[model samples]
Target: MTEIGEVIELNRFDETSQVDDPDLARALARRKATFGASSVLFYDKPIHMASASGSWMQAADGTRYLDLYNNVPCIGHSHPAVAEAIGRQAAVLNTNTRYLVDIVHDYAERLLAEYPAGLDNVVLTCTGSESNDLALRMAEAFTGKRGVIVTDLAYHGNSASTTAISPGSRSDRSVPAHVRTVAPPEAFRSGDNDPGGSFAARVRGAIASLEAEGHGCAAIIVDTIFSSDGVYAGPPGLVDGAVAAVHEAGGLYIADEVQPGFARTGDAMWGFARHGAMPDMVTMGKPMGNGFPMSGVVSRPDVLTAFCEMHAGYFNTFGGNPLAAAAGLAVLDTIRSEGLLENARAAGKTMMEGLRAMQGSGSAIGDVRGAGCFLGVEISEPGSNRPDAAMARKVINGLKERGVLVGATGPHGNVLKIRPPLCFGEAEALVFFGAMEQVLAL
Candidate 1:
């Protein structure tokens, strides 16, 4: 038998650092041996884990690292309140959606109340991919159209239909069709002095192209905060014009809020609110169940009714199970009771301002953009706006070495995505900012 230990060198982690586990690699090897290797693996480097609590994750080597990458842990990892709720529900009941359940109704009512009065229809799912797939279905059923328009690098979900609408699908070695992609408002890549203006122009061009192709589109799916495409929360009302164009072309507006919803933006419960636009369909996930596998789509009642009338039966095995509902309810309750949204607003202000201030002092810091807690710091070459993915990776990896865990975003992976749990405090931001400054200095 091949010795697994000789294939990799193990690194020791500090008490507050992430630990690596050989077991994870062994498991990966087992998968490779049986099911073949993953075609979409980003890197070979893997961080194995033991457990997570609050804002820290422990690895096999007993290292505890501060977490800044996990947007799903909105109430914070292993939050006692949410855990207790899940445990209670699991012990009592875990029924399917076919049975009448109060938890589902209560969760739907509470979640719906957050949106504008007319967008009240809701459908629960197990992942963001499912939510987006449902949104696509609604668009097709309501408009009897098969075409979709998506942002150039927008990431909706990994399901077949959602993948058809995602640019990441291509990078993941998947082919897509029947989708029109528009350039998002990116100041760095578009070479326009005004990213917002450039974005609008690109959108107009996409609409024109789609119209010419006889695929005018049933809907244009947009990530309200554009998380995967480098986190550009556009200038207020910038996307509104594009949305108007789509509407005029007889298409619905779909907002994929999987990464930026549920008060992650600080000012609003949903990222669409920040864009100053009302979406025809809004898909959400990640923070909805506080790390539990639950997501949903909120649509105009008429659109959902159309889907219902056309589809015969749309059933998901564990879409809105009792346990998932309990988790969702707990997440909402914790967000309200803890004032986490307010916390996100205050802490996010500190993070954005601090990053902007850092930009003034260092040429390595290119641009800082986003709203509330959904911010991204773009690393670039000195005296140029060009993305410096290498330096960005160094920064992120260095922070991880120093016991702080963050993530990289953008098409080139040069943007530092700072979406920690909504419960993250200003003090924690200061710590992260300080750590960032130190890493950059190094």
Candidate 2:
């Protein structure tokens, strides 16, 4: 077995364990066999995950990594509570929304209780993109407007409608005539101050641009934490003012909480809570089912009713099937009973402070920003904040070699996205930070 707390050398695994399991071997080989050689990003140290629990993942090669990118395992992978909940529901029955089930209503009621009062209605979908599509449809139906304002690097979903408004998505080769893009309230990029007013002004300018093009603004959709664009947890009330600008432009506001919802932020259960703003519609996903394929669009009852009246209907075969709902319920229960939110807050502070201290000391780190558990370290050239994605990739690869897995984001993919599961503890954070320091030094 690989030594605990020590990085596993790739040669060690290759020499010691020559598995004859055809199934696993075939599966691994298929990346090269079927999808060609370059399909995978084949890191120098790749973790063939075998098992996971709490904040750690054990690879097939018997190395343990302090996971910092697993938001899907919100309650921690293989949580006994969540497993039991899924088992109980699966053993009993797995059905659809057409059939009346008490668990469905119970889960909906429980989930809605987490949102603001008026935002009580929810429509289940299978992914954040679908949830966003549903939200867009509702916004358009309710207000008879089709124009949408989006942040410069905000990502929503992969669907066509979502891609239209997701400026961060590159597949949008053909820009939608009705969609407008605004700059995100990225304080770091906008010069280390509350960029709320400037960002809001950009929103108004976007609306003006759309109107100037004769496509009036209908809605403004924003990612609460701008996770894909590199966790920009804007200053309090920053997005509120942006929402106000959208509202003043006769447009609804949609908060895409796909990555930051379900209490990953630690400070608030949802990302909008950190912004201190009430969104007209909220799209959630990822941790909602704790790795199960499920997502949702939550909106005001009045807005939902308006869409309903307009004949807008949505139905996903397995969106909120009993199994997924059970998993979601278990996740929420685990969050409450285990105090993961508070854990996230404390651990986030420890990790962010560690990173901040490492900033000026190391020439690799440019800026460290984020809130709660969603932290990011912006990497740049020494003494120059000009984004250096090449060095960032080197840092990521170096960390991977050290047996620590982290992610990169930002437009240039230089911001290290430091979002571990909620169950991740300060101890794990300390280890990860140490690994980061070693990698930066290299």
Candidate 3:
């Protein structure tokens, strides 16, 4: 029997013993044998992808599907500039950070230029998980406290420490002793009149609980978009008061920008800026190098200094490699030259309005909310606000059959996550909207 409120992978593939397609059948068997129980794929029937470009993925069968489930490849799949940069650099060098690579310094300067004044120092990593892991260590070392607070449904990373603090990632609704959870600023679900105040109150309570347990509230980290907690992205300054509360208790605030950074939020380069909150440390990845495995942590000099003074020999081999640096430089150049930030604002406006308009089709769409290229459509029962996980599954499968890719998220796995590449335009947005309407009609 499944545990109650067990956080699960939505639309996880359960291998079928038989299938009509011989190639797919063989592929499934191979995956089962190689990856074993750890293997997970999306959709009822997974597609064997061959290539992808400009918000669309083509399968081995030559079927092109509009991709709405991608968070990586934010600039669009296999972007020419990024791919070229990686290919060109790989021919020359692939050395790690210990080497004094010119391109690496160039990339670091350009990336750090995107952040605000206070967060100046940078520690490069191979993935956002690693960046967050380092941030946790820094917080613990600086404050001499082990306590952390995150959203009830947040998913920061898959590392041991990150997983412990990620309440929703657990098989059951259990968190580690030093971790506390606060409700996200759910403007749509809760209908709270004072969302900022309510979020602040929750943070205050979590801090008190941590202190009572002798953890002393080292830090309160959050995905500025609250991506895993149903994509709460409204009522600007929603997290401002909560951040103030954390600061009042002398806890650092770490902004996990893996979801909402790199101009994906439309209004600002980072999600925390839109929320009117400044973070002590910012962890970023996902779209940093467009498709390269590059991530980093931006923090104040003093905080990083404190941590380094204590633990002098921390290093990651492939963290700031030359190829990643070249790719990062290319991604930065592409974003500016292609006008993606403005495109995100325009295309996102189209998507949000189109989705909100689609709500009139049926009561199954309980809510449509989010910012820029990242949005969530909450599925619910026809006559009530109760989440409809079954209907969500049906809708996701239906969209797949119609050559549109989307996924479900949230605590109940009923919130349809719509995060396409930043290059997605009006044409792509309309494609998804039309396909969604067709699915709902079915």
Best by lDDT: 3
Please identify which of the two predictions, 1 or 3, would achieve the higher TM-score against the true structure: 3
Compared with the true structure, model 2 gives a TM-score of: 0.90
Q: What is the C-alpha lDDT of each candidate?
A: 0.78, 0.78, 0.87
Give lDDT tens digits, candidate 3, residues 65-160: 999998899899999998889999999988878878899999889999998998998999989989999999999988999999999888888899
Report each candidate's C-alpha RMSD, comma-separated, in the order given: 5.8, 6.1, 1.6
**Candidate 1 error regions (>4 Å):** 1-36, 39-45, 172-177, 188-194
Q: What is the lDDT of residue 398 in candidate 2?
A: 76
| lDDT, ranked from best to worst | 3, 1, 2
Residue 246 lDDT in model 1? 77
Candidate 3 global TM-score? 0.97
The most accurate candidate by TM-score is 3
- State the local distance difference test value for candidate 2: 0.78
lDDT of 3: 0.87
